[model samples]
Target: MKLNLILFFFCTLVTISWAQSPNLSKYNEEIKKIEDTVKYFEVEKINDQFYMLIGGGGNVGVFVSDKNVIMVDNKYEIIEEVLMSSLREITSNPIKYIINTHYHHDHSDGNRAFGKMGVPIISHENAKVRMQKVTQLYGGIYDFIDGFVQDKYPTEALPIITYNSKLTLSEDGEDIEMYNFGSGHTDGDSIIYFKNANIMHTGDAFVRYGYPYVDLNNGGSIKGIIEVLGSIASLANDQTVIMPGHGNLSTKQDVLDLKKSLMNLYQKTVLGLEKGLSYQEIADSIDETLAADPVMPGAELTKLNYIKSIELELNN
Candidate 1:
């Protein structure tokens, strides 16, 4: 019996140690290999000073000024080094600021790496709060299925500067406006506008990713996103260039089109719910309507989640 207890104790200690720190060397090496690939990230020149870095995560807005470079969003930390290397090809200016559109990992995961370098990270107050805690994404739809868990950001990863509604920064004779019209993709979504450049980064609040994913679990709603989209459209003109959270660069008309599509889905959800239809039934109806629309893969599941979010909002 004593020998068995000793063996059990040894196994327990090993298990504890492994749990505390798992071996990730192989994982790290594999990820490095992928990151080192040249086509892992793509950069599109917006103009002389502004550019958009696509892939490796959410779209990164690179605004180069004479003094420093301001990034609208930094993708995952795993790609931080490679991302910086790509930026070096554009400008040698040091990164001055990183404005997080929201607290989602894809959009703000590099906060720790940049913040440690003394870069001032800016985000909406609510986003800062959300980042400080573990965020369970996709509402609870995947609670028993395949759920996405966003770990809590460390103090260094949290935004150093936070704004309530609107904050304007004057840099290189241009006004960079950050506005939080309300909760959309997340409670802290920021719509960034470069006044002089005539360019806008609509973060996740406005994405080209077929159907937008609302973080209903993190204070996001279909109605809120719809409203924010309209506000962003009003702020743009024919000359404005839109850099969405994901997908290719867009225009004001595209924003309006997205808004209309979401509005259509929102109305359909409401109507289905009023008629006592099940969530799946509503989603099916939505899916049929969106059959002609361009959507990302796995849109069927996305539509179900979208319908659930709208139903949640109406019920509340």
Candidate 2:
């Protein structure tokens, strides 16, 4: 009995240690698939000076020049080295700047990797604050998930440079402007524009995915998204090439159409609420209010998920 007890205690200790460290073979095996996906990245050249790196976590914008390169939204840390390898295929210039559009992990997770290499990161001041301080995320759908919320970012990962409204960067004969139009996807959302290229990177504020996710827990709202979309759309034209946070390259008309759809969704949702319909009921009734083109492949639940999110925020 004594020997059995000792063996049990030893097993318990080993289990506890494994759980705490989480770097054993089992854990590594589970993450190997993710690493495999990150090992291979895809690049789409927007023009001679600009390229798009996809497959990290968010779509990365690459602006290459004779002198150096600038990146927008450096996906997750897992894909850092692979992303750089892909970038080298296009330009030999070093990455001098990394502009984070928001504080979301998928968009800015790699900031630390780039920062460590002396690449200066720029973002809206609110984004920097959200990274340094803890913000309570409120929502029922996400409350059940453990480890889904972040309290704070590491000191090295925080944005080194922050701006209030707008900041302009002129390098390699390119004029890049970063603008903050209040809160849309987050309190510190930034819409970056390459002035000469007529290309805009609309972070999570504008995604190709159906029904944008508003982080109400992070100062995001459907109403705010509507307003922000209008502001960004005004800056586009027939010649504009929109590089959204996710999805394919878009034109100015696509942004406008999305704005109209969101407007319809807002009006329809309010009407459903007035009628005392349940959240799911309201979501079911608003199918016609969403955008129809470029249907989100394999994302059947995206609209419903977004509607549920809106329902949760509206009632709260």
Candidate 3:
């Protein structure tokens, strides 16, 4: 009886271990694949909207006026100083409103930096809850407080002003409208549309390069991203300039193209699953049918991940 019990315990432990070991081979390959994609630290003027791109895929927005400025998103904590310097060169106005598009590190990590400057951060109500958890757990708040001697973005830094769907900010003479596109990139994904400039900043939900990352864990969805992009596409025109969360500034056509690619990939995978292909089989096989179009943006989510995302969209 004792020997049988011991054997059963060992087998159960092995099974549990096997279940927990995630294969990171695809992740490593993704990092390698996007390594050559140059990360820009420069600020560029996209139409009337002045924008900056940080390493990774965070798109930082600067709506400048003689009185003050409203920054849509800050890239990373490290890049805050540089981004600030760039903003200062263009406008001497103090940064008043910083709207975070989501809770992703690349986009919202700079929340603390701006908060340090006494700037008020604005975001979806949910983003604050998510960032607060991250700051407490992985961000080492105790160490940060003692060593850095700096408040690593206290709770106040987290969107003192929260909203449900839409919020508008008027700084200087510019009118910027922030809209929550319902679980596109993340649960808190925001798109800042500059009403005066006819430029829209699609935060991460509108990357021009590779596949979009629907962080399903954080309320992201392939279908949601597609829906958001489609809405933006409808609002855009040839004259409308798009500032994506990553990649070069785009036109209305760029949004249309990205939407088409994503929808096509999604439909293809739905059909594949109808034929009873498993998720793995569908993900690994999507590229076979996609055939050398514009690749997806994120390294974390690769071409194969596109197939998996489609599979998820179908299952949901």
Per lDDT, the best of the predicted structures is 1
Query: Candidate 2 lDDT, tens digit per residue, 50-125?
Result: 8888774678999987888999998776667888889889989988899999997778878868877778999999
RMSD of 2: 5.5
TM-score of each: 0.84, 0.82, 0.74
Q: Which pairs of residues have clashing backbones in candidate 2?
A: none
Please give the RMSD to the true structure for each candidate, in Å: 4.4, 5.5, 9.6
lDDT of 3 by residue, 110-223 (tens): 776777777888888877767665221211111211111112346656788888889888766677888887878778887888877888888888985566556665667778
User: Lowest lDDT 10-mer window, candidate 2?
Assistant: 138-147
Q: Residue by residue across 1-316, what tens digits does model 1's lDDT show?
A: 9999999999999999877653435334534654675355687997899999987668999999998999999987777887888899899999888999999877887887888778899999999999887666764322222255676788888888899999999889889999999978888999999998899999999887677778887888779999999999999998899999988899999999889988888888888889999988877776453321242446666677667767667777
Ranking by TM-score: 1, 2, 3
Model 1, residue 36: distance off in Å is: 8.1
The reply for model 3, stretches above 4 Å from the true place, is: 1-40, 47-49, 53-57, 135-153, 278-301
Per-model tally of clashing residue pairs: 0, 0, 5
lDDT of each: 0.82, 0.79, 0.68
